[model samples]
Target: MIWLVIILLLLSILLYLLLVPIIVVIDTINNTYYLELKGLAKASVIEDNIEVLKIKMRILFFKFYMYPLKKMAIKKSKKTKVLKPKNERFINSKNLKRVLRVIKSFNIKKFYMNLDTGDYAANAKLYPVFSFLNFYKATNCNVNFVGENNVQLIIQNRPVRIIKSFINL
Candidate 1:
């Protein structure tokens, strides 16, 4: 009877240890799924907002260039350059301010903008204030760019050092 009771106690301890890890894994999966769902929802909203902005741009351009004054001016002289209004030229400025306000209100921990080589031409179009804010916020930062199987970090215009001290050189 003594041996049987000891064996049963050992089995209970083994089962508890095994079940604890299973519970932890399930909780981790639940949290990951929740975060993924939230990311998808945010992406969808951003996509919709971009489509709306495109529509607004189209309407503004048509109203500015297709108006009666524009037609009369074109008939009068073909040399006049029909330029966009100052406010229309600065539409992106307002949008950038709105984005910065949202970022500040939410207290974003990190911000990233992925631009291709061709995008250099549009750097002039970005708001100077937004660029300044980004630079100010980037102080004491760790930025990593992972491409394919290569990982690199840029720290203050220098590459981060990777050390393996355990191995002899």
Candidate 2:
């Protein structure tokens, strides 16, 4: 009856959310880095001052700011010795490959970069490498002689896809 209808509605909403893609945008040209869950929430890093950076999150009509770099007062306390666990697992080559595969699942929406190494010889050496990458990938990679370094990248992946990747691993 009414309960069944409500449950169905909630399930549909959950499915929609899982299907929605999460986007990551990085723009060094504007010094903006943000993660966006389409139509739901956005979190961005912003500079509070010359040396301080803060995270700003916006969900619908509400906005919040978090200062991760803010200094906190520390009180003197006794130091305790920490012991390492015996069953600790290190990331071997196999696990590293799996992690890389998961990252490769993300779709690149846009990619552009302009790099300057300050040395003319280095720039000359990098020009061929940049040209080769640009030809193979959907990216605008450039080596500039002038003093300019800029990058803008936008990538997205659905939650379901990420979950599927993890499951495969």
The Cα local distance difference test for each model comes to 0.31, 0.92
Residue by residue across 1-169, what tens digits does model 2's lDDT show?
9999999999999999999889999999999999999999999999887548899999988999988877789887798779878785698887887898789889999999999999999999999999999999989999998799999999999999888887885
| lDDT of each residue in 84-115, candidate 1, tens digit only | 66755545876666655433332223234432
Clashing pairs in 1: none
Off by over 4 Å in 2: 73-81, 85-87
Indicate which candidate wins on lDDT. 2
Q: Which candidate's TM-score is highest?
A: 2
In candidate 1, residue 36 scores what lDDT?
Answer: 15
TM-score of 2: 0.88
